[model samples]
Target: MKKLMLMLVSAAALTAHSAMAKDTLTISVYSFAQDAYKKALYDPFEEICDCELVIETGNSVERMAKIEANAADPVIDMAVISSHDALSLAQKGLIAPLDISKLSNHAKLYPAAQDPIGNNMAVGYTFYASSIVYRDDLVKIKSWGDLLGKDLAGQVSLPNITGTQGPLTLMMLDKALNGGSGDFSSVIAKIGEDADDIVTFYSRSSELAQLMNQEEVIAAPLGRFAWSRFKNSPLSFAWAEPEEGQAGGMNVMIMTKGNGNEELAYKLMDYWLSTEVQTRIAEALIDSPANKDVVVSDEVADNLTYGADLINSLNILSPAEIIANRDAWVEQWNAEVIK
Candidate 1:
């Protein structure tokens, strides 16, 4: 009877441990996250763990908002977010602190993607840089200051103030202000008056390609990923080297608090940052990978910021400052720049 009782206890413990070993996980990713999940994430995980992945895709802001809404109960397991949004979620304690040591692949990531800001609340997974794309045939724009004058005046594309493009444009404008030193009130006011000169205030980077192909708009301040289509065209991107240089944001991955899948989340992140997976994702035209150990060929590496040196050189705004002053910046943009 004693032996039987001990055997029963061991059996129960084993069952419990097996139940807890489930590798299947659900991920909340941005809509744009599909390509990466397909090329870099899903198959490798599925092959190794034989576990299914359920993807929940939405905008970064909306995804973070959902995490916030479910903070008390915790519906999400893991998510990808922009660096600023990741910081915001961490500040609010909506995300779980990552157990960095568990992630052996942690040592393989590019330094820029290594949670320089969030500690372990978030980790950089990709690098994206923004610059001006122009038709070499139409305009001769070489500097950010050139944007203000008459060279490509009527055939331009810019982001509308109420959209994501609005913030991106502000970052560029701030740079154009000669590291925030150039007097830009007149330039800002002129944009509002000259709004018509802008062919469209695009909400999506994909639209820039359409407008460019149609010749309705020749130049735009575009994200690196958006340049995939234009890479071989007479239309190409230039750094535009505003006196302050270019500013960029790192895409981040965060584990949601209390979803009962910490290990699975870490494993998914490890897979995503695996050098092989990172190379594949960058090649598939998804965003750049976060793994510094991954070496990319000239093609995938051309337009993206993937390596350590480039990632470190990327000038990004502070999350606290960007979030705190966003409203004021928008207000100033509308009052001074947008009119």
Candidate 2:
């Protein structure tokens, strides 16, 4: 009888342990800066929630595909993706509208960060400004039109039309040439006309950085997130404040539809967006804070897309506009820019 009682107690303890282990929240995130994220975010959240974070990291495209493939039964509880990507997922019914009340820090985010994708389907967590980064010693870039001017001629590079900064570059160049119209046909034709003048259409910021460091290219349009790579380079580089102003975009967080982990997901989202965490992430130079309450030193602010004055001044292209016209733009691009 004693032996049987001891066996039953051990079985019950094992079952309880298994039940506790089941408390987990799976998330999909960008592959970059995983170590920093683990230190500043993932580990702390795990400790606070007493739940494991099963992280799946990759580029936005692959992760979105996986989320779609498992739409009927979401493997990811929550994810962070570009606002346009979030809109696409929401359109496909792969993600659900957020319950803002669950996120205490929702009120703390910048107005643009709130309801960025509409219907509260997602919330912005970071903002990036895109502009020209040029070797001030070699050329002067005062306007977006200067990218194709006689001065930059063969020394400059333009972003490939397929990348995030591509449409932004087109938009600004259009503004410079035609009073800020949304139509990019003229821009594409103009770029084609000046194609030989450009060294190459770069697809990655890192690749662009390498070219710049090697003095193979002197100027290019780049997102502020990659500003550090050039700012710290041996060459003298400057972020351009063109007459047309800077183009900007946001990355957002979304909850998977019917993932049965709303409680835990919301918990993590709230914690991630809290002022403390935002400040930490900003200081680490990992992401620019969307929380308006976050404050950092001038030096840190210089390295990030910080402060309301600059954030408000940015001319952001709408996600709806991008989603609606990207296909047409791509077709035109392949025909004229690449061909």
Candidate 3:
């Protein structure tokens, strides 16, 4: 009878353990600085929630495709993607409107970050300034037009039209060339004209960093979030204060529609946006906080997209504009620039 009791007790314990293991939340995020994120945000939240976090990291295109492919049954409970990408998903009805009540930290974010894409479909997590990164000793970057100039010929890298930095670069170049028209046909044609002199149109900031480090690329347009890599390199690099000003945007978080893990997803998102977590992330120089409450050291601030002044100064592109125009931009790019 005692032996039978022991077996039943063990079976119950195993069942409880299985139940705990079943509670997991999956999040899709950009593929960068996972180690820092794991330390600053993921592990702490996992401890608090007593659940496993399945992190799926990739570029926006790949993550978006997965969300769309699994729309009938969402594989990702939540995702951190470009605001425009989230808008695209929302338009497809692949993501659900966020329950703002569930996010305690929602009230603490920047006013602009609050309802960034509207309908509570997404929330901004980080803001980044995109501009030129160039070797100070090799070249002087005065304007967006420098990429097309003969001085930087065969030494400059441009972001591919599909990536986040691509359109921002085009915007700044457009501004520099023709006083900032949203239309980029003229800029595209100009880039195409100088395509032979360009090293390559990079899709990833990390790729641009690699090329720059190797001396294959003397200058490139990149986001400030990716600045730490170039800053720490042995080679001298400078972040240009371009005459057209820096273009910027925010990366946001969104919930996948029909993903039954809404509660856990909300808990994680709330934790990530909290002042404590935002400060930790900012101090680590991992991400620029969208939570206005986050405060970091001045040294840390220098490394990140910190300060309301700088954030306000950024010439941000519209997420809605990007979503509406990306497909046409890609088509034109393939036909003109890539050709």
- Model 1, range 75-162, lDDT digits (tens) per residue? 7898877677777778888888888888778887776577756567877778777667777666776665566557777788886654
Residue by residue across 1-339, what tens digits does model 2's lDDT show?
999999999999999988777588999987666788999999999899888999998666678899999999889999998888898899899999999999999999999999998899999999999999999998888999999899889999999876678888999999999998889889999999999999999877767998999999999999887787788788999999999999998989999999999999999999999999999999989889999999999999988899899899898888888888888988988888789
Judged by lDDT relative to the true structure, which candidate is superior, 1 or 3? Answer: 3
User: In candidate 2, how many Å is residue 18 off?
Assistant: 1.6
TM values, all candidates: 0.80, 0.88, 0.95
lDDT of 3: 0.89
Ranked by lDDT, top first: 2, 3, 1
Off by over 4 Å in 3: 1-10, 13-16, 19-22
Global lDDT of each candidate:
0.71, 0.90, 0.89
Flag the better candidate by TM-score, 1 or 2. Answer: 2
**Window of ten residues with lowest summed lDDT in model 3:** 16-25
Number of clashes in every candidate structure? 3, 0, 1
Best by TM-score: 3
TM-score of model number 2: 0.88
Off by over 4 Å in 2: 1-22, 196-199
Which residue pairs show backbone clashes in model 2? none
TM-score ranking of the models: 3, 2, 1
